[model samples]
Target: MRSPLLGVWERLRQGSTSFLVDASLGALLAGWAVVDTLAEPALAPAACLPAAVASGSVALRTRAPMAMAVLASVGFLGYGLAPGTSTPLWSFVTILVVAFAVGAQLRGRRRWAAMSVLLLVTYAVQILDAHRSPGELTWGEVFLTPAVLVLGPALAGWLLQRARRQAVDLRRLAAELETERGRYAAAAAEAERSRIARELHDVISHSVSVMVVQAGAAEQLLPPGSPAREQIRAVRNTGKEALAELRRQLGLLGTGGDPAPLPGLDDLPQLARATGATLTSEGVPAGDTSPGLGLTAYRVVQEALTNASRYAAGASVRIRVVHRGDELELDVANDAGRPADQRGSGRGLAGMRERVELYGGSLDAGPREGGWRVHAWLPRRSGSPR
Candidate 1:
């Protein structure tokens, strides 16, 4: 029951037009007051004018509610004690409406003070008016009049204002709850990513260390220039490279950034040779480049060559880097080789694409001319913000 009443009150608070509700209310009360004046043979139509002024000013209740309430109360009492006029029911009703408006619209200490003054002033006026006519006066009627006129509507309006404040607080709390939920979810995802990075670092580092040790033992046991010693040397070199990569990954997981300087174009030849690929370049300089761009370029070549080594082992691979004015381009192509039974996690290619796209670049990787190709174009400009 309480909820339904609150909903109704909320609907009424929503505006229709400029004072449409207030103006309609004022007009109705004025008409009723005029009717009451006409019914009283002693009261003239001129008496209706003051009542209309008092009631109609309620249209400005939201703008000046205290003034409206005071005007209505004064007009109702003053005219009630006029030379030959009687108080009308509509006049008292207008007083009630204006009193409620004062409580609902006025904020802070001013509202309570205005309400108290209205009650006190109305009480004094009623008593003075009754004292002028000796036989018609009663204590109960005087007290009841002020209580009914001031307390009822004012309390109702104050209660409504409190409810409106509570509704606003509830909405703010809900928004805060949603924000907290999103923050918690993000934190959880980051923690999980770090956990996976740590696990990979531990497992891969231990495995690579064991393989390097075994390869070194084999190379030492074999006679110099033996065919098997060369293979063992290659295995040891690959294990060392894998260990370096594992350290880099560990640094990223622990510190959230690369602690060591990233490999750039200079390392491309070694990267290509490790994967048995031929490295070539055109128009690119051997000097310094942007850290972000260089890191992205290195990763692109690394991921492509890694993919070729895993999925197309013993294949003929080619890597090319080109430096066009305002752009850097990369291409890695590999002919089909012995098919591997296992596939990758797909994260390496995705990470490469993400890195390229971060610099407003483009990447394309797919089958082309009986071989797999990965191509990327990254932007470069002097004085560009990193």
Candidate 2:
């Protein structure tokens, strides 16, 4: 998608680049030999047989090198013995490329051994000017020349193969390094956020504690049943509630101490009594519910009760929990009443929403029937990722 050349390259590689290059070279060289054969009267159409074999056999250098070696063995033998004063350099270059391919691409000694024999037979019997008989063939001509010509190109090909392997290994290492770098960045970001949260918690806790103590002192100076005494008492009570909520939230963030377990269905009765809310349930007993669903149920009701106390004090609050086989449903609602203090950061609703979603559930909080309502649907037995 990023580059048009990437698509072209994929097509070329799939077609086998080595086969294409070798086949093209073979066609050009064979065409030259065919033209030379047509020019010479002595070398008729029959002499072009070896040229045809070499042309096609060169294409299989990588796919099937042994097959090419077998065919080239028969083809070059005929070309060497063909009626001519001498052969051209193209014929020898074709043989050299074949020898190099065998050494570089194949895995076993048998292929190289076969190639060595082919080189010897082709060199010894190849058409030459003032041709010598078999007995006149010297040791230097037999071993030394063939060794130099065959080994030189084969060594080059082998070195190229090694360099290709190193390039592939380096690419793999670079990809792994990129993955590790991303993981480290994520860990550092999370640690920084936690550090800021702890700092904020300390500052806010100290300030709120000081306000509660001063309010208590103010109440002591006032007469019993005075209008100012009640206001001071409310300030002290609100500060206590804020501290409790702060501790609950910090506990959820892995504070590394003996943290109390979150309230659940089993503690709903006590929670209702403390908040002056009524609780009703259906379908399943508290002990039969999964811990994750029960915990979510308790939190939803606790948040709804806190909201009612803030905005609709002395109102009728009701908590309902129902188990419908595969799912658990919760609904908390309050009747319209007097508006009390309107102070909140609104984090309780956000926290309850996120906590429910972490268990793959949903929370719906909004106004209903002139009062606020929070309804949540949670799947039974699903674990919380938090």
Candidate 3:
């Protein structure tokens, strides 16, 4: 439940272009009108009636600028030349604010033309008001007063408009850059998948093919019905199947798929064994994890394990994964290697961070507790905030 004042504030926030500032200016002028009226001999507020009305035009300055300017200026001539009580202070302020609003609202040649008409009318009001009661006003006051009354506020409004346009242009440029960055990240992930496909073709596939050939040669060297010959035959058959699987994967990877759902969390234990790291998990894994997020998490852990293997060789490395309902947390820490030594070049870590962040998660790799640690908090669903 919102308080009445809060609801009013929310309405104001959703109001016109310069609603708060104009409203504040209007309020200040209205208060000054009250003060000026109380200073009269009869202490009558009615003397400030026209000023109060003009102040309202100032409040809705940008809502209908040209119309309000016309009304505030042309409508003000009668009060300006009136010979009785002095015009209320708010009316003068309203003219100035309205002039400023009109200057800021219109653009290009049209602004100058509209401002010209507004300036002439307001200046006439200023001059008439001055001539009617010059009370202790100097010669300089008469000459410079119209300029202050019209030119100053209009110039300030023009400056403000220029600044606002520059700010808008800068914001647009920043948004474009952000969108470009996202495209680059996506391209990088695609490139990595294609590269993996190439490695499997050039390295693993060729090795498996050669092993199959070599196993056939070895089986021929062995005597018929020998126990070792059967084993060699099984090895050759397995290598052929692996080569076929690699070709199948290449079809997917070569076509711009993202990471190809390679080696997700379920495969991390074998990865831990290969890299000589202890693995631990907590909480039940969510069944609905997106392929993109699962693949990103796998790549992050793989990079960490590889770094630990290369830099911390004989150091104790531990990999921990925790399922927190909507997100997953992975921590790879080595107890012996220095953070600086473990994070050298940072190319691999940077790629991992980009992939993780593309899915709207965070990656932090640094030294911790006399060791180095790579920490990643990833959402279970792709692109969901963690």
Candidate 4:
């Protein structure tokens, strides 16, 4: 449970403009005097002076607690020895409040020194009063009374300072933790983007170079105006176009760059023909697809075709696409070919899976019926294909 002094310290921390807190303490001291005067009319005059001194100075407790404590302590001690009167209880309470404030507000050796002086004065008063009335009160009562009054508030103030320090430390640590978390997330995202960029470069540069070299060689051998010669020229032109597109896409990473058009399901036919794979489709719509879904679908096909060229070259491959109203599905299967250590670094399939799953899609790839099959599904937006 929280201590009462800690609760008071929290109120002081608020630093309110209105002096309600100080006024309340002053009111409490006056109230005690009024009650005591009603109970003992003969002692009223003697209590009034000390009461005024203690209560009137309470307004400066937070700003000048040490000074207030000294003033209040002296007034309390003087009232106790006043003729025809005992110590005013309210005056003693006010002194404790100031002592607690001193311990709480002051820092380092100053706090300890101030509290030490206050306690010493309190004991001196008790000793002098006891010496005046020898044998009336024992040394134990003299020790215990000052000890309780002096030590209680000081201990409470020390506890309050410690608790406030701990709370500040916890808040600072929490802010640091949040900052680290955001930095880590941004770092991870940048790393992933770089990885994807590298993979695209590898696939495009290798495939397009091969196509260009093969088409040029065929054109050199074929006769002019031949149908096959025209097809060879088309192949060379297509490879150049694809390479230029890939370069434009890479440029998008720079400042003030225009985004390159991403190939989608509509481009699958050309992609499959270029990769020597047969293409088939069902329920595929014809207008613009969402950029995210289209890019994901394009990457899925690209990765699968690149894998086939590596693991199953010269093999017959078939690619199937099915467009549902809310999602798109793709499958690429190829018959086994010359198996020349086609087991990849596994990054290709991992990248493809990452792309598909990013859009709440699923992917599956494994050997099936003496061939390999890659399948994926991606969520689709409600729009016509481009």
Q: How accurate is candidate 3 locally (lDDT)?
A: 0.74
Tell me the lDDT of model 1 at 85: 58
- Candidate 2, residues 1-386: lDDT per residue as tens digits? 47989988886689777768877866776787677667778675777887667645677777777777777777766766777624556666777877777776765686567567666656665424226445555556655666666677667767776787789999999999999999998878666555445543554565678789999999999999899998999999999999888777766665544333545778989999999889888886534554455666777788889999999998999998887777788899998889898899789999889878977889999899888899998876643333
Q: Summarize candidate 3's per-residue lDDT along 3-112 as a digit string, tens digits.
A: 99998888767884578877777777767765665677743455456555556667667767776666565546544544454445566667677768877876777667
Tell me the tens digit of each residue's lDDT in model 1 across 84-109.
65445676777788778877888888
Q: What is the lDDT of residue 80 in candidate 4?
A: 57
TM-score for all predictions? 0.54, 0.51, 0.54, 0.55
Candidate 2: count the clashes: 0
lDDT of 4 at 236: 98
| lDDT score for candidate 1 against the true structure | 0.77
> What residue pairs are clashing in model 1?
none
Q: What's the residue-level lDDT of 4 in candidate 1?
A: 88
The candidate that wins on TM-score is 4
How far does residue 358 in candidate 4 sit from its true spot (Å)? 13
Two-way TM-score contest, 3 vs 4, winner: 4
Give the alpha-carbon lDDT of every model. 0.77, 0.74, 0.74, 0.75
| Candidate 4 structure, TM-score to reference | 0.55
On residues 1-386, what C-alpha lDDT tens digit does candidate 4 reach at each position? 99999989888767655367776776777677556745775665756676566555566667676667666666666565555454456656766776787767777887877787778767877787787678987999988987788789888988898899999999999999999999998888776665556446554555577779999999999988889998889999999998888767765643124333557666888998888889988995635565456667888999998888888877899999987778788999999887655567789999899888777788999998978999998766532222
